[model samples]
Target chain A: MNLIEKYAAEVGKYLPSRNRADIEAEIRSTLEDMLEERAQAPNADREALTLQLLKEYGAPRKVAESYGAVQYLIGPRLYPIFEMVLKIVAAVLLGVGLLGFGVNAVRMDMAGPALVHALGKLFVDSFGGVMMAFGNIVLVFAVLERVLPLSDQKDLTDEWEPADLAKEQDPDRVKTSDLIAEIVFTVIFLALFNLYSQYVGIVIFNDNQWTFIPVLTEAFFRYMPWINLLWTLQIGLHVWLLRKGMWDVPTRLINLAFKLGSIGLAYAMLIGPAIIKVNTESLAGTSLAEVARELSPLSQFILVPFLIAMIIAPVVEIVQTVIYLVRRRSSVPFPVK
Target chain B: MENDELIQNMVFELRRGIISIAVLSLLGKEEYGYSLLKALSDQGLEVDQSTLYPLLRRLESQGLLQSDWRIVDEARPRRYYVISPQGREVLAQLKKEWASMTESMQKLLS
Candidate 1:
């Protein structure tokens, strides 16, 4: 009711329901005692002064935060790691969510009228849970990492000697050899998965036997049967890391390369044939007519970047990998064990 | 190791297990939140209430500590915590382990 009581209620609001009333009473008494002490001293407006004191101590949230250490899924000491995890989680969630929606729409549209309702139900039923489960697991792991941190940490509140605080930290870099193997494995897997799924969907569903063995499709799937080797390689790489008890600069660099390669492969799958068709048409016809006709109206704008993503983007990944590995490794201790 | 590193390591090591034991031992006698913290700190353990409170909540949630709020102070109600039967069993096992560890470490030091 009064200023002290108001502050008491505010603090109580943040506390657990069971403890609220008692904490509120305690806070009220404590504030009243403080106000009485303040009143004994000279103050212009005693009542207003009490209110000012309460405000300075801060609102309920600040008071509660002070009482409890500011905890996150990742604490302040490991915030960079937390932030990275958050970014990866958000990206993965967004990517998966979009993929689910795309798959749902495509599968729904593709189904015949007889199976339309059934297919729609089946697709939603199967994938909706998968997407939600993945998000939940990501959230759980993020929280776990925050709560049970894996990194070496120093209490932020500890006073530090400048020499100790400023001492150079030698960071471990991701191993390049490990990364190369991972990337090679990942890219091959991605390329193969793309070719296989496309082959299966385009060929088997095309409802034609002869078209299934089309020279283009054969060349594509044939060139990349080891695509699933991505899975084997990734498992192997992780096993190796687990065994070695560390993954530093070189591995991260390779991972970046692999990611770039995947994006590149995706781009190639999207539009590589179009470019080939265009070039072949021009060569055969001795003119741009056939090429121009066959190329979609917006094809060049789309496919040029697609090609760049396929070729140049992987190169960018290599650069990013180098930069990331160099900076992070400089501070990290090696052999994470 | 030097004195500071040794102390630091000891503090960190104590931190890993002490909270569990302290909570168990505190609850072993009787269960009350602020009083328990005061008692521990009074005994020179000096644990922050911030850490103690959350640890209490976590232990309760994990079924190691059972708690219920009672209107004991008349003016202010408070939650009381008690070691569950299972918690007592765990505490006994932990005590045995601690004793053995201390014995071994002392022997090695000697």
Candidate 2:
């Protein structure tokens, strides 16, 4: 084959398979055109002219890239979200893993090999969590980049308006960080509640053994369906708020409903049969009756205060929502200087 | 040399955006890849062969241009491109936009 044919073949290797033949044909024709223009001298060798034209055109890969179909595992449009998601997931995973390790280390003999063993476990678990998070995030974004339409992939390419700046300057705009944190925590809570409910308990280290005492009673389990429903709703609300990037009336109303539902669940748990059942016999040096009497007042101290906060927090939110509605209605400009 | 490279790069970017409009406007008269390149260069657009060929395929794919291959009795076959009706409509709109933008920029600079 001649220089023009060789050049076209080399460029074809880099092109997408479906259009390779057509593209190579066009490139060859264009190369001939360039050669004819350059080799205007009467005695110019055609082979030398072809070589000179190919040099000026560019390398095969560079010429192919000019077609503007560069391949990407995760494209620019999805890259920012992918990066943010990976960071948040890694942070949450590392936090939980280290907290578990710290608790286990405290329970172990500090001077012994047990502490070393706990540290090793922490390293392995945290590394595995981070790798899994990265892989999953990349896979999800790759799929999204493939499936999403050009219009939907507007995060990178959308034309900005002055109104967008005004929206950014809005004082009552929803904080993305807060919404992401809520999403992460709600997902963790739901996963543990549904799949690992047994681990959601109190553990005591006594007599060189770890004793996991069940804290939540069957009555608590009974209320879980409603609690799970509310948690799911809250997660949905947070995700929607994240997508919207700002809080409006409808979202606030939805958030108000979620708060009320959560309060109701908390109230039900308070009024129901006792949720924590501490087996006093498992207490290292204490008698059952003595442990029970001591624990009763302590449990009340924790539970009663928690219940009050649950109710009060939602009530305060409801009042605040009403005030915000009134303020918004009065045409008070946002982002007060 | 650095300043020359910078100017070349800026001019390249400026030309890239209008290359489609330029090509579409010229292909109102049917011409193959090589002739079209000659026509554009004659008009002082100076588009590269590689860039022009790919752009023609892309515009054709986007339904803005149509192509057909013709073979004469003693000549190698050549694929010719012509502006579609769709291309004409888009070209008109682009020309209006270009006019308005030039006027606006001129005012701003003055």
Candidate 3:
């Protein structure tokens, strides 16, 4: 093989399997073209010249970066947002997983093997699913970044003017107070999680002996740490939005929708069959289960409030996001602040 | 008045608001790595790559900047930076403060 062909094969090792051949062919052609140019030069040694060009062109890693996927926890373009989301998600997922493991271990000690196996499978499935989903998503985004051309490349048309670029920004950009608010909100979430944990301890676990109250309460408490982590990320998103000085109105609405969805889930947990047994046990023979079961399916009396809180609240939040986006856009400079 | 002392104070005061504003404003565009220093310097800020690069990283860790990389050519690549929304808002507010300070300075000098 020629000198150029040798270097091309070496660099091909780093590229994805699908693109490797094409990239190799491109590199091979380029190198051969370079070698032909040097063919007429006085002191050009083919082998040494090939190596010199490769060295200047960079190693396989650098060369591959040109055609490689965007770096992201879930994908290249989505990486930053994905990473921010992952830190929040992973912290919660792992914490919840740990709690699930603890609970299963506890149940194994106290109850039969059947329950233990069920809980174990659930924990494994949940944790494994989350991690796998994150990895797969990053892979997908990296692949997409390779395929997509979403970059801002307008500068190639016009050389950037040094003077205009260097002009100092008008003072009155960035507020420290916003950062402080984010910090304060995150601290509030942390504090609330601690207090809820303590409250669960007093009402359920502290009473000794496993009861329905403790079992269910522990489940909620186990998820509380995850809630705290979620809160931290939510605040982090706020901080990112503040710094970027631009808001995606739809994205904000989506966030509100998700928050409301979660609240809806909590409500479902409260009134659903799952809660009936716990409520009946905790509050004495009033048997909240029997009462809930007896209520008419068409009963809008209770449903109205629940619907208002869950469905209506999110709608209001979406409207608020739209209004906020419009207002901020008017006030803020573009290219993001 | 001492020329050196006056220049020193002027530099310090200019820096007082400028550094934070510049950092915040830069991050508002996109997340970046060490190139931030070069970009700043190329704009005539003359920030030390060592100091500015580390600070950019710190701000990112603090959740103010987001970054990613792109290849401009088949032979070379670079990481890009942008500012977060919160960083933008912060920049806006800081700009307000900076303008007011500049006005006050102008008044005093006049």
Highest-DockQ candidate: 2
Report iRMS values in order.
5.6, 1.8, 12.8
Tens-digit lDDT string for candidate 3 (A218-287): 4455455556666666666655554454446554654675576556655654564431123344454543
Tens-place lDDT digits, model 1, residues A93-139? 45754554454445335545634544344445446544643454345
lDDT of 2 at A3: 82
Candidate 2: where is the Cα deviation over 4 Å? A1-96, A103-107, A112-114, A125-181, A196-220, A235-251, A273-312, A329-337, B1-11, B14-18, B31-50, B53-81, B84-110
Candidate 1 lDDT, tens digit per residue, B49-91? 4466667767877888988766764634456789999898989
Point out the higher-scoring one by TM-score: 2 or 3: 2
Off by over 4 Å in 3: A1-3, A9-77, A99-127, A139-309, A318-337, B1-110
Give TM-score, chain B, model 2. Answer: 0.94
lDDT of 3 by residue, B65-92 (tens): 7665465546333456678777777678
Judge the docking of candidate 2 as incorrect, acceptable, medium or high.
Answer: acceptable
lDDT of 1 at A31: 59
List TM-score (chain A only) for every prediction.
0.31, 0.55, 0.36
Docking class of 3: incorrect
The list of candidate 1 runs beyond 4 A from truth reads A1-337, B1-9, B12-16
